[model samples]
Target: MKKNLFIGALTLTAAPIFAQQAVQRPNIIFIMSDDHASQAISAYGHPLSKLAPTPNIDRIAKNGAQFWNNYCANSLSGPSRASILTGKHSHKNGYLANWNKEFDGSQQTLPKILQENGYETAIIGKWHLISEPTGFDHWMILDGQGDYNNPDFITDNDTVQYFGYVTDLITTFTKQWLQTRDRDRPFFLMMHHKAPHRNWVPAERHYNLYEETEFPVPENYFDEYEGRFAAKNQEMNIYRDMYEGHDLKMVTGIDSDTLLFDPWPDAFINTLTPYEKKRFFEAYRSRNNDYYNTDLTEKEIALWKLQRYLQDYLATIKSVDESVGQILDFLEQSGLDENTIVIYTSDQGFYTGEHGWFDKRFMYEESFQMPMVMQFKGEIKPGTQVHGLTQNIDFAPTFLDFCGIKIPEDMQGESFREMVVSGSTPEDWRQSLYYHYYEYPGIHSVRAHYGVKTDRYKLIYFYDEDIWELFDLENDPTEMKNIFGEEGKENITEELKKELSRLQKLYEVPGI
Candidate 1:
């Protein structure tokens, strides 16, 4: 009886220690959608949010924190992705633009740090960095600007082509990877999607979605680009740039693949299986027929193109939303939601007819800002809104902070984990953000420029054109007017310039 009593006492004493040992680092799943705009997301409260709601994506914001003013370090894909992974700007990371550049994967990245600290890391889906990913135990990424239908995935051993829509296929592969991953160690999965990018292609399930639906045109859809030399010189205008053959899936009457205006060749269309090709032609047949018949003015053509573009864009995003739901459901089923962090953001916010543009390159708010919503399961308070300035460069440090790993000294961004928990702006948070875009003499013709953005003002220096643009965001939220040399704003411009100089020095950017 005395031995039994002593054994019971020992078991009771070890219970708390055993429980403490069971506590593990939280798992993280970062979901990124290419060119997803905050304005298009239902959580941001844009007008179209009601027309096309993203309920699953909004659930993250509802359950955790919604960052209202999340901006990108550089408003380009490869640069932004590199910034997120390396916690540094393009100058430091060396992925300045999508054209003629490949990400140097040997450097210390977020995944590498996590993997070093006993975490299993994986990345699946659109990786536009042009180099094979490093530091991931398993990775499968799409080829450059991967095909929307039946995309080809570049895996470790083989470049396998998968059928079905790109978004759905990515989700399927992600779920499969999750099932087969080593269950002993914590995991960090990056589920990237290529939907809603240029030449938007909707899944067959959503091919005819938004038919006869008219999304309201942006207030600045017909912007004249007055007073802004860079804006006037840009080559991304929706009316002039979005080609029927390339963007709208409308083929020219000729069979020649090298037509002057055909942006996408017929060979790409042939990439679809026969059944998919039949469905694709059938879905767009009436629209193409109507487009050729309709006699419209340039303004009317622009509006027509905007409608078609948005319809396809929103339709493609619908699959992304569904995929979000699937992942969330899987987490709940696997009981991983109790101790995991889920994040949803985009490489960079896209321009959906804002300033009559379809692509993202400029440092304007529509292109410069990224939508970020994170749900840290039980850790974060529900329905929290973080209004402080945050950028993509902070992602790496924040993830490291969550995993209890020491962030590297060379990384430039600070962790926002405190902001997420407190549900309020930090008193010492950054007052301004720096932005740079480097791909000029390339697509869009947007001059390579760097800028600084404060809470109320923005200053952009078009270095290639030697032009400056300043906007009081409070007064001109749409940024329709350039207030650089305006009458009474000399002091504001000077103050912004001083701030810009300070940031350039702080970030160690060259030739400020």
Candidate 2:
């Protein structure tokens, strides 16, 4: 596998200066999961991570570079994925919101470019863009948000149902492709996962994990949504919005409020084998019965629900972490570890009880920040930490640049390959990031909003109601208080707005 080495510049001091050689491009494996938050990842140092550690994910960061200021252009799965594929924002890629949107496959994308440049490209996992994947020699994707158990996959030929946990099946397909691929050319693989998403369902092995553990409640669990009107009206709160039977898995109550929500729990469990179902119920039935039978106060119920939710969610991630270790192990065993660049990231971040919420759509710190860790063995220094800002849009350009392919002029993202290699941010790197969310009149009832964030301050504008909020992130990392119009802060607010305008103009986005 080391035969596909750099074409020129023998030293690995920085990104290689390579020509148009078909045989020299490095293989890249992009491992992305749905809605896996940075806080849950142990590498990012959130206290919750100590409770549920992810050693495999932390390995990538320890072995190479971890970006502390990584963000997504939009916080939803589809939009963030589109931006990553095209190195452009949501509006440019034309997949604004999730529903009623199909990715325009004919457009230029990273996979297409890599395929054109003598790389055997394949994607085997969650593709929620609602269109036949283009630009890859092979693709096998989930059928929209994908069932966690015995899921169906849409291949180039036909849709086939696989009998196993979704994470394991996806990992199997990825390894199978690698094993039987045309090895003359370097390979680029996108191994995506659907675990740890909504209605969290763990693999059979992880069903009993965290059963006895009680996760500490977030300090802002009882946040009153003071001063921020948009926060007050959201429908994503864990206590307020999660369905009783579907989310909490407490499925045997008489009241309508205690029933499961549509399209989960029942849909997923009914597909399992009787043997599997018996094991599943054996793991959960006693706890569910205890919850439904015992009398509890309102606060107790909320705490119980939050604890249960974390247990299930974290359990789902355990399988994903295992899948990552498998891929890393394969690379080492097959001698591909030297040249293959492996990345671990999520489509977007989620709120793991931050602001007492479960879903993501807001420009708040919890949901807006995405986790990005990469391993390039000799090129990137171990323990490298990048404080400079990077966004999802930068992914396509960075991959192209690393592969010695010319990035298209139309891409709105800048490559940060050299910065990662040198373990230092260049002085000219981006100082701030821009974010937008347009899924309003939609799920979670979060209003359509856009915002800008520098190292210290953040400014958000909810367009529907002409609302504006500002936070001094340096002073308030949790973003609990909105300081939009406080005295002596007028200068910071005005400057953030100006920077927001500059970014919008530079990106060719129309001012809101």
Candidate 3:
């Protein structure tokens, strides 16, 4: 084992309950999506929900506890997932960025510990760790980011290509696993979906969704990147970075005059049948024609692209929402609803036209915070909202705690199961969250920085530029102005710097 694989000093809580006859351990289902922002989900009640409503995803919140303050230690995909599996931050888990090397499968992981504790474990969907999964007794994962049409899944035996929308196929596999799983033993199933990621493509059925309706542009859609060096230098803006052929569904030769940069949709569009391709193109025919034919102002172009972006992005989520309904219905019908825990969350949050950006490499609020909702039928009361601080690292320990297994001493996160179950905040719960983003001088041109976020203030240090920024979140919720040198903030600035250092030391972030 890479670390302490068992609890040593911790007292045994509820005796290993899975071994009991009458009261078998509850089944665990963790459902995740890639780059799915909370703003897109209607349950959170953000502005985007006005047009793109997600009823099924909201059902999870309606029937269970919703974490209003959940944050991801790192905002990127691979790093966030690694943190969840290992119950540690990026620096400790060693998978700090999407481009980082394969995950160390030898490390002590949640699935391995669960399997050791007599639970059946499986992961079906996007597993971008780059290493073959070790702990899962059964795992069928996607190849790379995975294709929207006819995605390939690497299973225990072989890599098989499944022809269908990626979301439905993954959900189909999850339901299959649930149906065939041995009811005698409890199971841990990770139903991950690849939807609403970059180069957002909607299913054929939803291609024309929100086409007639125009989405309101973000107030700061034309952000001038005033004082922040990192914000001014990023390459993720909607007007410039979004690909002509890849993102907007406007083909270079047919739909526009510009050359394609990432032409992402081309990778799998050919896999579709001729009929499928014809219908797909037909759906975007009007939109493409209008863009190629019209000439608009600079801001009008940005607004035009934003409309195209939101339509496709939100439509992709429609299928994932439907998938949730399918699974929830399955559980309720199969009698598993009484003794199962179903969690709905994303790998991390992404930007949906916020700050005129598209990617999620920043420590800004849009990318820094993630959405989390769990439905444990008997345990969590419906509509219960948790305001306490939590992060992705808490996932592993919470799972272990729920199943009556001792959390390994090496895990950095504590179980919020009790805090959530009790439906109240604890007296001495976490006060501040520590965040670090290391992937800089790479994609999106975001600067390397780390910071500490309490309820009201955020102090960030852009180490590479030797620049510091302070945002009083209560007064400056938008984080538009940096108040580092402003008068009357010296005491708060010092306190925040001290808090940042304390968190770095507490979380054991590599360097002092």
Error of 3 at 373 (Å): 0.7
Clashes of 3: 0
Q: Model 2 over residues 1-512: C-alpha lDDT tens digits?
A: 36446532343334333223434678999999998999889998888778999999999999899989899999998999899999999878888889745999999999998988888889999999999899889999999999899999998899898999999999999999989998667889999999889889899899878888888788998899999999999999899899866777766553222336635654576768888877776778767777867899999988898998999999999999999999999999998888889999999889889788899999998889889999998889999998889999999999998888999999999999988998888999999998889998898999999989999989999988999999988889889899988999889888999999999998888655
Say which prediction, candidate 1 or candidate 3, comes out ahead on lDDT: 1
Off by over 4 Å in 3: 1-22, 253-266
lDDT of each: 0.88, 0.88, 0.86
Worst 10 residues of 2 by lDDT: 11-20
Give candidate 1's error at residue 54 in angstroms: 0.7
Residues 448-508, candidate 3, lDDT per residue (tens digit)? 8899999889888889899888888888877888888899999999998999998888888
TM-score of 1: 0.94
Tell me how many residue pairs clash in candidate 1: 0
CA RMSD, predictions in order:
4.7, 4.6, 6.1
Q: After superposition, how far is residue 338 of candidate 3 from its true place, in Å?
A: 0.7
Which tens-of-lDDT digit does each residue in 448-505 have in candidate 1?
9999999999999998778899998998999999989989989999999999999999
